[model samples]
Target: MKQPPAVKRLFGLYFHHFPFVMLTTTEAVFLHTSILIFAMFIAYGIYSYLPATIMFSISRASYYLFGESNTLGANTLQY
Candidate 1:
């Protein structure tokens, strides 16, 4: 059975944006992982900004790139 035009379009978009989506998903996963690692390091009295800053920047960048700026209820940290 053939899919409808809308479904095809959606699939096309998914394929077109798959690279970016995958990167974003990886960044999100890494962000959480880093948070846990950083928290542990902090508990051990380690001082560093690499994990927090990198993850925060990536999230902010992704938010802007994903059209969160024009969407309702955006965090407003996009600039």
Candidate 2:
């Protein structure tokens, strides 16, 4: 079955916005450009996740940006 063009476009938009909605950083990093790609990954993970689990990791992602080094921060963790 073919999906409608509108649905596909919506998915693309969701994926694009996924990164921004996921990464919640209070402290602005001095090196922001470097952070953008990685931030997107975090967003992807958040959106891909089931609702119940998203919050737990979302908080961790926030802390991860604050210089905490862990697998979660790296987007290496399996869902």
Model 2 ranges with Cα > 4 A deviation:
1-30, 51-79
lDDT of each: 0.71, 0.69
Backbone clashes in each candidate structure, one number apiece?
0, 0
Per-residue CA lDDT of model 2 for 1-79, tens digit only, reads 9999999999899668656545656433433556787899899888887675777777677776776554444666558
TM-score per prediction, in order, is 0.27, 0.24
Tens-place lDDT per residue, model 1, 1-79, is 9999999999899567645455687786786688789889887663466677777777788778885653444645556
Clashes of 2: 0
**TM value for model 1:** 0.27
Worst lDDT run of 10 residues, candidate 1, spans 69-78
The numbered model that scores best in TM-score is 1
